[model samples]
Target chain A: MAAQTKPVLHGYFRSSCSWRVRIAFALKGIEFEQVPVNLIKDGGQQLTEQYKALNPMQQVPAVEIDGITLSQSLAVIQYIDETRPGPRLLPGDPKARAQVRMISDLIASGVQPLQNLYVLQKIGAEKLQWAQHFIDRGFQALEPILKQTSGKYCVGDEISMADICLVPQVYNAERFKVDLRQYPTIKRLNKTLLEIEAFKVSHPSQQPDTPADLRA
Target chain B: MAAQTKPVLHGYFRSSCSWRVRIAFALKGIEFEQVPVNLIKDGGQQLTEQYKALNPMQQVPAVEIDGITLSQSLAVIQYIDETRPGPRLLPGDPKARAQVRMISDLIASGVQPLQNLYVLQKIGAEKLQWAQHFIDRGFQALEPILKQTSGKYCVGDEISMADICLVPQVYNAERFKVDLRQYPTIKRLNKTLLEIEAFKVSHPSQQPDTPADLRA
Candidate 1:
């Protein structure tokens, strides 16, 4: 995908939530300028007064699109899928959409929120363990559901919003060193999703702002 | 609403998430049988093998609707609004729906997950403070957005899914003793939402399984 000035995305390279939006944009073939918000350097640029004015939550990737700045990764993904031209991220059938959303919400609210950086920070020295615990629990629940719904993608053969949500979360789970071998379905899906061009381009290492030492 | 056998909702009386669905059901005037899943007694009925078979996540409310059991509160709510006969829970315009979803996500992923009973149990002694901290942070972000979009509702007088997510969260906040005085917008919205029949009927205290002494 070529870079253009359609939307400005403020994000950190390693943030799973930010990566979710990046993957969506890549899949949609939408050109966006990446404005790196260094989450580590000088204590997170997202916390700055300027960024706070952009997003009161002080989270990333807050995107400037459709003449407004939007926050929350899932909402941003839905907005992009709705307003922009894309292979539809959500399924057309309401029941299929519900199934897709079920997986998406499983990750968004059930998995990612409990194990994100902010929650890890709050968990203190046991952050890694805390992350692994939640990821394992979420994956255990997700594996059975995915087994029921998945084909080549999370829901049937199509790459829907569920896949968009799943890949990044699996990235974070691996980062936390949560063993995926136990979750065969998730492991298989993650491996398959990582091979996709959209997922490849949106990888944290591939981000323009990814540090040299962290580059994969 | 007349009692009918369309959906069976397995939910705890006090769960904010379950309350969100209850409010949606009430607003949509869909009659669902409530099968109480006691989260406290017998070490949480949701953890039992039978309940886990129904919903591997072991969370309430696990709803049996449209011939399949659905878990995850947001997904269930979306499914209800989408598949059933009801007033629309989301807005018509894409941008409007995005705004509504943004607020809903802020509360769902940002506020509720961090402060839910499971996490509170994990937080141990400092659970109350942790709950208050997150609720305050979320309400701070929410107050401004609500200020922009709200007029008798979370988004321009129509009770979108954001309002469904909000009313129950405010209930949880008050339970945690989080001061709402600082968030006048949230406080006012909560007050107004409470007066509505749907929100009133869905209050935790009014649920069929709510303990008699706890009944309001």
Candidate 2:
């Protein structure tokens, strides 16, 4: 709660939601500590009572900041943007801001949740196929949207929260073997976004908890 | 686009996402026209090319307002709250706003998407079981958070976006047969919320396209 206390991000190395928060922090130049709650270790540490106390949803990337803990990456990102001085994660124009939220929600809700660890685990042996199916379907819808919305980034020339959402989801898409060529706008935007310092530092491979073998 | 032109909402009667937008409109005292994009009739009208153009995501509750169209119910709701003069759907304080968004995203992304029509159709014969599993999981997590956050609604006494999201999802939970008694906070909030005119007018059973048998 003290102003001098650094924010602590409790997250997993490869979780897309965690990566989103990392990108927001890096973009905002807000120094934060990492406390990895490995999703796969010891039958998922996130499910433990300790972590659940931090986030009743028991999800990764529960951030302790501004005197309270916040989960849901978008909420944390918006909080950072609201309280900190940096590039605006949401654009000034109401229409543009709405577009950004629309795109972010499409990926966050419509796409990512279907292929996430818990859902895929419940999907059993058909996990790969299941992930592939949903990712492909999502990207098919997303392609045209990005085509309509993108200008150097997911919204416009400025890097907004939509761009923050884009890179991680495209990473998940590739991991699931979703063909990127099918979504030219998304692929181009992801490529452009990855070149930024904020995105590079926050990437899954570069995280503090990223396994050595997977390090950039 | 004109100032005098009424906002038009393209949505299905029973879709939970659509219902969220409806509640927001009702709460704002904004009179809007409904252009029903029936999700089930004629093989999912939302999949049609015309609707896809309105919302590249091919989802419901795309609102045509202020010379632009917005998809994703939360995005539309936020835009309305920002542009209109009425009861604020999002509280003004930063932390409280983030909490509202967190709760909204928890349901919108984490729970509802898993058991939505498209997902359920893909889930085949196990759809009922799958819906129950995710709803139960989501409600279990939501209960404690609501207990922590709720005063008279999902956030505080104000009818924020989290409350807009809560009613529709609880309706879906009942349809899927999740036991309400287990989630006392959610049940209590939903009960109190349902008594409000905003929620009553926006109920699925009272929608313009609600089938006669299902009408309130």
**Top-scoring candidate (DockQ):** 2
What are the clashing pairs of model 1?
none
lDDT of 2 by residue, B1-216 (tens): 445888999998999999999999899999999999999999999999999889877878788998888889999999999889988998899999999999999999889999999999988999999999998988888898888888988888888999999999999999988888898899899999999999999899998899999997
Off by over 4 Å in 1: A1-5, B1-5
Residue pairs in candidate 2 whose N, alpha carbon or C atoms collide under 3 angstroms: none
Question: What DockQ number belongs to candidate 2?
Answer: 0.83
What level of docking quality does candidate 2 show?
high
Best by TM-score: 2
User: Residue B4: error of model 2 in Å?
Assistant: 2.1
